[model samples]
Target: MISGLIMDIMGLHRFAFHSQVGYTWVILAFVHLVFNWGKVKAYWRHRFRLHPHQDLPTPPKQLQQLEHTQKSDRRSLFFSLLAMAGGFILGRLLPTGQTVDFSSQKTDGGMFYHQWSKLGYPQALRAILNWGEQPARYKTYGDARQIELPDPKGYQGLSLESAIATRRSQRDYLNAPLSLVDLSRLLHLACGITHAPGELRAAPSAGALYPLEVYPVVHRVEGLQSGIYHYAIQQHKLELLQPGDFRAAVVTAGLGQNFLGQASVCFVISGIFQRTRWKYHERTYRYVLMEAGHMGQNLYLGATSLGLGACAIGAFLDDALNHLLGLDGQKEAALYLITVGRVETG
Candidate 1:
């Protein structure tokens, strides 16, 4: 009664306050509850389907309440992100109302976008230069023979440190072939067998959710049949994918990058998110990228040690690549590409 009397004396309209602020809060609360209920219901349905026999409480009343709380938390986060995006877009778009005194500043400095223009990164990294002298395209597909070496120096000289130090993007190749032993060794070191004898397994996957698939593109590796091969890590052998000199098509798929053209072989890292995301839903994306990096580094180190060449490729025609690998880019989609070759030199 005292508080009511104090409010009346202040002439503060209680009905207006209640209708404005209280109504907004109640609406938000209702939406939050509804959003959470939907989320929890879907989760429960998926969970029930996955583990039908598990002795768990049915997700109706209590689960709805718990999910509503979580949804509230998530809504707050989403709104915060929306606010940031809105502010950033507004700032960028809004006109400068007035020009301030700028005599003290350097002439080169300007706004953020203008400053970006100063740091001249190549407009695009996939610019390809055609050569008049192309190595005679070896027409034969499935044949094994001793590979030809241009000079003994390319093969005889061997050191990991030197190999790494002198690495360059060399796409022009002498008409020499890559050896089978070299091919085998490269495959072993980059992506070889582990102790997983299970019918379907990959190198220690997150939640045993092995998500990566490796494919090799073969062009001029000798004593080994020329064809695309699947690295059977368990068997430590190549499962032939297709027989052809598909380098041109693969290089084109890789956005016409010259290094891919000169590469004797390449590795395509594919992912099966279901194998992982089933266990770790949202965060599985992070793990998948991390795993790709790990595999890429392995290729680099393995190539360095074997006195061969390897380069990780990020730019590629995503859809064409999927087609090149005969993949749908859905279930087991390629994540990374690595080109490997016997580095050519003077």
Candidate 2:
């Protein structure tokens, strides 16, 4: 049983081996049960008092020894069952390559239908119920320093086809500092609001509920302090969150990916789930993840357009990044990262 559970946890699901072990275990259990039939009968007789008028007979020395052995076996079986159950639950919770469908028709939706539509909740109701006071479009810090970004309009010069053709994940970067104009263009194209009237942004969000937030970790940006800064999309500026260089900490959070610290700037994308959860409910998670992907792609293409190298990083310690950014893992958590810098040329 222990070996079977270990194989399952390691994703080594050899059907032939598992089947053989399973059948053998079942047969052994049956045989053991048959061998203990006398003890089983005696136990039931004593427990239920089926023979109330007949006094219980004392067992002989060998029978007592057998009873003792059966008790020990029962105890071992109980612990084994517990260990198997615990291993199964742990394996299910751990990350695996296999895709598991958590959605149910009753909760997620039916064919050509979703839970949001089934609820019959209007957009106006969502605004009133989910966000009564209208959540701020931009996040602000009280005493932290701020850096106003350059105009983003002047930075859009690259053609769409050219940017798409040249887009690639770049890991090697020159030891250089990115200019403020380049940083402005990257953030604006990635997530900044394009249309202020309807609160629309460069990336398409589900139901216009922009749940994604951008944080730029400045490593070597020219004219910018080395610190963690929150990108205020609406204002098109940076709000300093923490002072001092975090290149070392970022590398640690990124699981020793030294290239992360070499970038001119690293974008940390986080999601505020409740923003979308109010309307989509159980399906909110899917939208949040999709939104993150959309923003990451935008950053990639935007960096390419600006003639800078960009790499989308997915492998990182979730808790480490959250702690580095001063975010609670539940309400707001880092979902993705993008490192951008000048491409090294020979």
The candidate maximizing TM-score is: 2
- Candidate 1, residue 151: how far the Cα is off, in Å: 26
Deviation (Å) of 95 in candidate 2: 29
Off by over 4 Å in 1: 1-174, 194-205
| RMSD after CA superposition, every candidate | 20.4, 13.5
How many times do residue backbones clash in model 2?
0
- Over 78-131, each residue of candidate 1 has an lDDT whose tens digit, in order, gives 898887777667545744333223344643323422322222222121112221
Candidate 1, residue 201: the lDDT equals 30
Query: Which pairs of residues clash in candidate 2, taking residues 3 or more apart in a chain or in different chains?
Result: none
- 221: Cα error in model 2, Å: 0.7
After superposing candidate 2, which stretches have Cα over 4 Å from the reference? 1-136
